[model samples]
Target: MKYVGRFAPSPSGPLHFGSLVAALGSYFQAKSQRGDWLVRMEDLDPPREMPGAAKLILETLEAYHLHWDGEVVYQSHRHELYQQQIEQWLSKQQAYYCQCTRKQIKAAGSYYQGQCRNKNLTADNCSIRIKIDAPVTEFVDLKQGKITLPSAIAAEDFIIKRRDGLFAYNLAVVIDDIEQGVTEVVRGADLIEPTGRQISLYQLLGAKPVQYLHLPLAVTENGAKLSKQNHAQGISLSDPIPTLICAMRFLGFVLPKQIETANIDEILAWGVKHWHLEQLPKATQITTLFSNRIS
Candidate 1:
C-alpha cells in the first residue's frame, strides 16, 4: 500500500468547521506520509442532498488548499456497480431480503431476529441484508485500540439495499473503496459501531480491508455537534489560509508564531511535513474552535 487515503463527505450541506477538522486531519496525515489524498462526494441519497452543496464543498476545499489527487468519485454514478455486487452476494445465498418494518425491529429490543430469513420473497418492497458471520467480531484500528461488539450485533443481519430502492451506505462505501484501492479511511468517531459490518463486507467481497481511523466528534458550546441539523455555518472560503492555520492548530499542531502569519500553501507545506497522528484526541468528543475571520 502506498498510503492512499480519502475524505468522503456527504453533500448534505457545505463543509462546516466539524467537517473541516476531519478533512484537514485526514489530508495532513496523507500528505505527511507523502501519499495520495483523494476526495469522494457521497451524494447517494438525492432527497437529502442540497442543490449546490457539492460544488460549494469543492470550491471551499480548493480555497483551503486541501487539494485532492484524482477525480472526485460520486456515489450516484455507481449504483449499477452496487447492483452487480448485490447480485453476486445473492447468487451464493449469502444475502436475503427482509420486508420487516421499523416498527417490528423496535419491538425486538436487541437485534433483527431474522424473521424473513427463510421467507422466499422478492426484493421489490424489501430491503436486502447481509448475513453476519460471527468471527468478524474484532479488528485492529489505526487510531483506536482493540474493540469488541456483541455477537448479536456482530452477527446481526444488516441492510445492503434500502426498501426505497437506494443502495445502503455500507455496501456502496465498501464497493467504492475496494474498487478505488483506498488504503486508509479517516472519518468521524460516531461511525465506529459500523466498522465490523464493513470489515465483514470486505471479507465477503474478498477485498483487502483498509486501515481505519475514527476521529473524535466536534462538539459545540451547547454540546451538540456542529451539523446541518444544528444550523452550523460552513467554513468561510474567503481567505482560507488563516482558517487552515487555525485548523492545524486545533488539531494539536504547534507551529512557530511566524507560521501563523504564513500563507495557506506555506502552512500546508509545513503541515504535511510535520503531521502527527499520535496527537489526535481519543476522547468521544472535541470542542471545535469556530471563527469568522482568517486571522
Candidate 2:
C-alpha cells in the first residue's frame, strides 16, 4: 500500500501556531516519502464549530502552500456511513447502548465501570459504546517512542456514538481513516492518550493498523496547550513565511538563512528535502514564549 497521511483539523476556530506545526509535520512526513498528503475537516460537532472556520483553515493551508491531494472530507457529510458502522457493531454485539452520564462516570471513578454493558438499554436516550475484550495498552510512536496507557483506560468500553445523536471522535476518526486508507496519523501529542483505544477500534473493525507520529505540543508558558478553546491567536496569514519557518523549526528542521527570503513554495521545497522524523523532539509538550508570534 502507498503511504497515505492526513491532517484532520476540527473547525472549532482558526488555525493557530500549534495547528500549523501539526499540519506542517504531517505534510512534510507525507511529502518526504513521496506519499499522498490529504486534508479532512473534522466538523462533526456543529455546536462547537465556528462559522467559516473550516474555510479559513483551508485558506491558511493554501497561504502556506500546504496543498492536499484530494477533495477535503467533511465529517458532518458522512453521517450515514458512521451510522451504518454503528448498526453493524450493534448487530454483532460488539457495541451496546448506555445511559451513563458524565456525572455518573465521575462518581464511579476516572474510568467507566461498564455499568450499562448488560443493561439491555435501547437506542432511546442512550449512547453507544464498544466492547473491549482485547485491550491494546501499548504502542510504539514514531516520535514519542514507546507509550503505555493504564489498563483501566485501555479496557474501558468507550463510546462510539453519543446520546445527542453525534458520532464520537474515536469512532468517526477510525472509520474515516480506514475508509480513506490512511497509513499513518501525525498530529499533536495531546492526542497520545487515545491511541490505544483507537487501535482497539481498528482491531474490532478488522482494519489495517495505522502508524502514529505525535509531535510535541506547543504549549503556553503556564503549560497549557495552545488550543482554540484557550483562544490562541491564529497564525499570520498576511505574512506567512515567518510563521511557516517557525512551524518548521518547531518540527526540528534547520533551514538555510537564505530560505527566509524565499517564497512559500521554495520554503516548502527545502522542508520536504530536509524532513527527518528523528530530528523531532521526543518530549510530549514543549513550552514556548513565542506562542503568539512563533518567530
Where does candidate 2 clash, by residue pair? none
After aligning candidate 1 to the native by TM-score, how far in Å is the CA of 242 from where it should be?
Answer: 3.1
Give me the overall lDDT of model 1.
Answer: 0.84
Question: Which ranges in model 1 have alpha carbons more than 4 Å from their true place?
Answer: 289-295
**Cα lDDT of model 2 overall?**
0.91
Cα lDDT tens digits, model 1, 224-287, are 8878667778888787766676677777788898888877788889888888778777686877
User: Candidates' lDDT values, in order?
Assistant: 0.84, 0.91
> TM-score winner among the candidates?
2
TM-score of each: 0.95, 0.97
Once fitted onto the true fold, the runs of candidate 2 whose alpha carbons sit more than 4 angstroms away are 291-295
TM-score of candidate 1 on Cα atoms, chains taken together: 0.95
| TM-score computed on alpha carbons, candidate 2 | 0.97
Candidate 2 least-lDDT 10 residues: 286-295
lDDT of 2 by residue, 194-288 (tens): 99999998998888789999999999999998999998988877889878888788888888889978988999998899889889987888887
